[model samples]
Target: MRYAGIAWTDAGYRVEVLDGAGRRVVEPSSWGAAQVSELIAWLVELAQEHPLAAVLDSTNGLLDGPMTAAGLAVCRADPWLLPPRPRFGSVPAHRLAEQALRTPGELARVTAEGGTLTGRAEEYFEGVRRSEPIQAALTAAGRCFEHGRRDTPQVALTFDDGPDPVYTRRILETLDRYGVRATFFCVGHHVAALPDEVRRIVAAGHEVGNHSWSHPFLPDLTPDQLREQIDRTGEAVARVTGEAPTWFRPPYGALTPEVLATLEGHPTTMTMWDVDSRDWSRPGPERIAATVLESAGPGSVVLLHEGAGDRGQTVRALPTIIEGLLERGLEPVTVGELSAAPSDRTESSRQPAPAERP
Candidate 1:
């Protein structure tokens, strides 16, 4: 059987084509996606000359389309290319440190060496390091597409600063009644305070995102600190819900270039709202609903808050907001579903959810 491997590097992608005996048929070097596709096609033709089963590294999901199009059976490489297992358990923060400590071992070496960890050790260690969780979340997010599903216009409803023991339940109940799904951007402290609420949010078929560990302005922190904020929050959420958050929203609509760079390879998508209801300021349900309706459009991500103080306006606005979107020919979806693509619209018109009512 022949195998092909593709790796993205600082210079570009390195494509390798191997023959039946695992001998190199093509040398590896920087190649663009289109060139890589051409190379793969050539390799497949060569493989056909030998009539052998072909294996290809598809960790990035890049070859999914082309491989399937070419009638090639593509299997994802194990997190680190180790033997198959039932599941790769969570990688603890300390384990990541331990792996780093190894410095020269296979586990530590892969990450330190800087390439896509495509082997078994890489996947296992990544899970242990909480790397896989965040990456998985981000992968789920990037899969969001607009015209891929159907032509019917769909909208997503998202609420930040939530999982509040008091208000989140009410919001969930409303969502349940309407058979709608929304995304909740949760604070680490809040999730820690109300673990049950966090679980309930997940169980109710809703999506959750990281608002931050303490809701700090991302731009205010150093790159390392910003990562810490996101990591800590992801760890907390994963601890309670068995899943890491895949979406992130900077507090106060603040994000810096450093913050973006810090998040580059972490796997969570940066989510911003499109339709702002201004419900955080006690804008009244009528005004909140009206604002959302006025701004609603195809692929809109509406921002609402279930917790963060005096969310009564948002709570009251829910049915009207959903109804209004429906009235305007929009289908409310989760932020995961909304921000899946560049063309996807998100509603960010709302004020910050009120922390306290004056």
Candidate 2:
């Protein structure tokens, strides 16, 4: 009696059977559809003989619909266990080397020993793992709700790189007039420079998130630098607001393998905006407001910048954007509240239809 597993790899499917001693009893590979079918049929027969539990990897299981439908049980291993592929086109070797620096134990050992993998590859591995837990949790939570989840249209307004004394105050006033709340991704240096503004953001009940200390591209920095960027920023936010930030938005939506590793187990949700308002470019207020209104939908994280440059247009655009959302029957909410909001299926005192994902 033992356990058996099937894993899909770049090379094809691999089947491994383990005996009571946790030793491999059988190993086989199937390269073609017919071979895969025969191998799976063989595995089922072997399972009956040994009364073994089948633990096929989920990613591999999905590849063979017949195997899954045949009642084979599945477990998931890190999807990254396979060889890496370029997200789009080929990436530079040095960059890949940097990304690889984040994997632990056996994987790291193999990557280091292979000498073919780069530091970037290690970093990439680490970053993917860092955000995996949060994504898994959210997805699981979403699966729990079954009814009352109306897929209603909704939108969220988010401002980043901010807590500016002049512009933020004006933005807050507009939001207050509309009785709306927005999320602000505050840079650490900005928080330090504008403690009063940061405190006002909290006092006004807006959500605050870390946007890194000085908005550096995370992957370019070493592990120590990456840690310092996040740690110092969080500390600065705490010093000003009396509470550590629990949300993080990487600078310019950029994440590197090392950056992801450095963020592991941190009590922050990495946030990315769905819409860009071009406020930082000093676009006309009307143009900025129109862009937000046009692009926003339910579950949209509309991005605006409160600092980083003159934001007079952004200040001017706030009221119009708020008004437009209200007219379209949307409520502007902070990212935290949005995450905690009841799913479309649940009926609650504050329950509303699920907003569309931007």
Candidate 3:
């Protein structure tokens, strides 16, 4: 029997289909609205090829109506309920504990900061525990990440929107001087133009990841457009680095359904940040440093930028951020190293994604 599993993940609404061999694979979206008259029309066409059932983890199984309308069967199943999810891969246990145990004041502060992290984590993992297929889809897609460990001092420092001819080099030099490892998510166009910068980032023992092609808001693009953004970026980075990035950050962290449809089989995890430096706003280095040092703990992903602006202050603040983190007994690692399981974690420990990939 052919079946599909659907869950909204760090990506958009994630849809996985069981192929003829009963192997779960990413479902190619036929609802592109290009040639299709309606989503139901497309789903109906899909049904004619084979009998299909949908297994959903969310009580909000938002896809149920469309599936049933398309003449497909709907079944409530929790592929993530018992084993894999919330525990599988590298879960930021210490981070989740911090979130789940937020004090009233802290909760109010997070709310004021527009953070929905705690609620999202609580709901997603609860479903992951009961649904095997849903868990598989998320896991295979590299949806796992870690924050700081409860007993140890390990965190990640991630910089995005870079390969700026000047600023990136400065950041690299600083990181090298301090013998620190950080993760850089580079844009495709920038990578192509400055393969040298990308190489420099990789050569310095830092992790490199795809940050998309032109830095478009992904949700606004079609499936084909999104795929181009991802594939071409991966190709550009792979051409210079010899290995395709196993990590991805949506441009401006804008992940929506149309956006994630293109990432089905890609061998990359979605990386997110736990701490916000707000450096992109041109916040002074002092505020940036204070934000990270005060909010960071065992499993935090500190977000900063390099190419999106002058980045001089960020360069200046780099040493202070590192030193302060150290004084707090926190060890900084790359996003790849920080993720507990797939080790390609994004540590989406913070709230809403920034403008695009952060």
Candidate 4:
């Protein structure tokens, strides 16, 4: 899937095609917000022919409605996730921070540039369901788990869907620098591409878990594909660490009955988070830190990202998260360690259940 970094060009628009890594793909060109809907429509039709994730800058009340109309799903994305992204062309060059950079009429503009073509787009674009009914089935089967028992005062920190060459190493270094050992749930393809990082992670005495081969929504894949996703990811992790990862976190936390049944005896635990950093949205470094720190406790598993877009916000928040948690008297441990510790079982009893995707 190709991502684009777009900017407003004095009178119109400009964009630079980017790889998922936020690497430049093409020379910048004028393609302002006005063209976003058409592009979204084109992408929607194209997805029927090929798999593509539409990552866009659609701020200021633009694009998402059109995307929803074009049969493409809409999830909030943080510009921080894609650093050095194309800013609105009108933004001042002196601005050092990306989030601080903005267009002149963001909140002030109340009218849509193009009149609603809702009926036309709806004829074609259809929204996907939040999740399959299988989630409830898995919950009933007792296969879905929001977290482990919080017996002790130590909380486990698990980083997901990464092993990226840049952020992963920085996170590992931060953990090592703090003398904290956390778990990293890695993707198979990423592990293959950066096996050295995997070795470095294990060498640092941090735990590694499987996060599937392709990061697909397990319920969307056929049973065979799901099995391959689980098995292949474990193999890749084991190939580097000499032992299969003992945990599995479903991509997007979209676990289903088939998912649990497929790995019934695979020695992997289905892990989910009670607190989401929302770093992927790049709210701010301070807010990210606060979210993790505020929700942390004896058995809290804070959902933080090390990969999938730029995680610099996560990096920025790391030291604060560590320091704050420590000050609050919480120790960061791995998920495996969290489950293994005999839980008072009551530490998290009064806490609200994690709002994991069901």
Q: Rank the candidates by TM-score, best first.
A: 4, 3, 2, 1
- Scored by CA lDDT, what does every candidate get? 0.57, 0.59, 0.59, 0.59
Question: In model 3, which regions exceed 4 Å deviation?
Answer: 1-148, 341-358
lDDT of 1 by residue, 125-237 (tens): 43335543443454365521122133547787888776676689999998998888888899775676578999999899888888876554344356665676678779889
Off by over 4 Å in 1: 1-152, 339-358
Write one digit per residue (lDDT tens) for candidate 2, span 230-295: 777789888887777777787655454455556654656567666788665555899999898888
Error of 2 at 283 (Å): 2.3
Global local distance difference test of model 2: 0.59
Q: Please identify model 2 stretches exceeding 4 Å from their true place.
A: 1-153, 341-358
Best by TM-score: 4
TM-score winner between 1 and 4, please give it: 4
User: What TM-score does model 1 achieve against the real structure?
Assistant: 0.53
Q: Say which candidate scores most in lDDT.
A: 4
Model 4 pairs in collision: 8-89, 13-30, 13-31, 14-29, 81-310, 151-344
lDDT of 1 at 325: 72
After TM-score superposition, the amount by which residue 246's alpha carbon in candidate 3 deviates from its true location, in angstroms, is 0.3
**Model 4 RMSD to the real structure?**
14.6
lDDT of 3: 0.59
Q: lDDT of candidate 4?
A: 0.59
Where does candidate 4 stray beyond 4 Å? 1-145, 343-358
